[model samples]
Target: MTALGFLYPGHSAEDDYPRIEQLLGSDIRLPLVHTDIGEDAHRVDALLEMGSAARLAAGVEELRLSGAEAVVWACTSGSFVYGWQGAHDQVRSLARTAGLPASSTSFAFAHAARELGVRRVAIGATYPDDVAALFAAFLKDAGVEVVAVRGSGIITAAEVATWDEEQVLALARAADHPEAEAVLLPDTALHTASHIQALEAALGKPVLTANQVTVWEALRLADRRVNAPRLGTLFTKEPLVQVH
Candidate 1:
């Protein structure tokens, strides 16, 4: 079994990992270690602390013992709030500490978009407008265009985790732009594993959600892929080769 370790920040949607594990297959395992969420607010200062090296480092031992081959910082806001370079440094530190490949949800979204050859995407965010803008900036640095960004103004991961199927679909529909090749929901705290296919069917385009990309990112770190059509378009197709 290929084990992917996830250093999730707090308790919002950590459950998404297990659901994705079941969807991926019996041969794949997702072991999640919840890092300390100093403050669950989606604010900048709080997120920086939430994704700090110290908090992330605390989980490495647990994941190492879980037989994880690669580790991911599974919180989107926590990582993106650090910007592109900062997030990279965060992952690098985590990898060095864990002695495994490391990545974060922010990069996962960027890589997922690149893998799908999607240059333009619309964001359906659960964060405030300012926080969502930071995510847009991070994506822009990664060479992805944010056609539009719609924020829910939700302040905390706890609030985002309470979102249901209807809320998820509504956010996707509201955030989608005719010019966008894909729609992205950039919040790992939101429960979306069960609604990926439904969101795609509603938008008639590829829908990339946080938890979905987080799992895909983990598999990529392990140089592995699995057939999981139910996980949405990201899983149904082969990764596109991007020529830099």
Candidate 2:
């Protein structure tokens, strides 16, 4: 099996990889490692402020040393906080450091949107409105049109993780816009991957959660294709041609 490495902040293994395995159907190997980003309460803001190409390069090096075939920075906020150029530079630096392919959750969303030929999108954020606005700007830079955005004004990463499925579904439903061809839930800590199919069903549109896009981007970089119906629209839909 091909190996893919993920660099995350402060979540446990139990929280993420099981869903990835279920989505990929035992065809791929995922090796994940966590870097200390303070604590869950402060990590999102801290990573947003401190995430740099240098820091990501270091993390990728660590994952490479551990035998990761490709490295993925799994935090959506961290990559977008740097803006479009910064996110690109960070991914390039990670690839350079690991001598392998690299990507981030932020870029994953952009690639997914482009692949689907979606110009209009609705954003569902677990961050403050201001932070969500920043994410929207980043998406706009990537050529996606942001038709609508709704922020849950969540303050901390841990709080985001604790959000129940029903609450997430409700927030997504509220955030969905009729003009949007896709709805993006853009926080890796929010556990949106598992609920994507249900959300897509409810909204009758494509739902691209952070983790789902992140994994999809990583797999694309490695030239791997996956068809995971349980993971939702992106996977169920046909594979998109690589951008650039």
Candidate 3:
């Protein structure tokens, strides 16, 4: 069985992983482990200061006990606020601790964007503008083009977690630009999984939300991939990477 271990922050939206599992075929397994490594604050420094390899280490142990084949640090801001190299270090440390393939939602966004052949994207963020700008810069450093970005200034993860489909769709629309090939929502706290196809249909383009790409990247790191049509273009497309 291909079991993916997701190490999410304590304050993340609870349904994202479960929604992904429900969307995937019966052949895949998703097991989640949480760590008290995040704060309610959504500021740049606050988000950056939230998680660490040490904080995530115990989560790896829990995932290992659950028979997880791979591990992912599933918080976007927590991973990206450290910049590109820092994000790399975060996942690398997790892999060392877990003795398994590892990745983070930040890198997952870049990988998933490349997988979809999206050079330019618009960001629909739940963070304040300053925090959203960090994500846009993070994507730029990762070699993806940031066509446009808009933030809602949501101050806390707890508040973001409570947002419904309508609010999310509005963010997606607000962030879209004519130059963008897709609209990206980069927050693990935002519940974007259940409304992925709906958002895509509304936008008439791809929407690569944090939780969606996190699951996809975890599968890829584990050397497994699932093609769930309802997941939108990211799932339907044939990426350059080998899916075993």
Candidate 4:
């Protein structure tokens, strides 16, 4: 079994990993390290905007201490709010901190989209329009076009976590455009892995959610190839290329 580590901001392990485990079947082991970055709303935006290298480094080190082969910074806004260059630097800093392969949820989205050969994407976010704009720009820099975007104007991470699957699917279906080849729902706090298959069935296209891409990217880094159809089309479909 391949072991992968997830660094979450402020969510419980019980709520996060079950879907991933279900998607990967009963074979893979995912150990998560939860950091309480979301408790203080005042510092949340600052931490995300200015780049919390020290805190992020601490989180990565904790995951490494827990025997993680590879670590992923699981917060989307925490990484992408820094813009393209800042995001790249954050990943490099994480790699240095953990002394292992490191990636962020934002980076995973880009890599997943690129690997799947998806050119145009519709984005659904639970953030303000400005924050969503930053995410869209980051994807554009990665060669994916943002055909459409919708934001839920949600502020708190806890509120986002409380969002049910029906709400998320409704938002995704409403946000999707006919021209878009894929729909990206990028917020790690939201429970997206559980809703991916349903969203794909509704949209009739691939749906890349935050946790899905994060897990997939971590597995890719660890040299684990999973073909769990219940997860969604991405995993069931052949990888666009072999990383090795």
Q: Which number leads on TM-score?
A: 1
> Could you report the Cα RMSD, in angstroms, for every candidate shown?
1.2, 2.1, 1.6, 2.2
lDDT of 1 by residue, 175-215 (tens): 99999999999999999999999999999999999999999
lDDT of each: 0.93, 0.80, 0.85, 0.81
Q: Which stretches of candidate 4 lie over 4 Å from their true place?
A: 12-14, 38-44, 47-51, 242-244
Off by over 4 Å in 2: 12-14, 39-45
Q: Model 1 off-target regions past 4 Å? A: 242-244
Candidate 4 residue-wise lDDT, 70-135, digit = tens: 988887888888889989998898888888998888999998887788999999998878888889
Q: Output the worst ten-in-a-row residue range by lDDT, candidate 1.
A: 235-244
* lDDT (Cα, 0-100) at 88 in candidate 4: 91
Candidate structures ordered by lDDT, highest first: 1, 3, 4, 2
Better of 2 and 4 by TM-score: 4
**Candidate 3's residue-wise lDDT over 88-143, tens digit each?**
88878888889999888988899988887779999989899998899999999988
Give lDDT tens digits, candidate 2, residues 135-171. 9999999989999999988868878888878988988
Model 2 / residue 126 / CA error / Å:
0.3
Between the candidate structures 3 and 4, which one is better when assessed by lDDT?
3
Q: lDDT score, residue 98, model 3?
A: 93
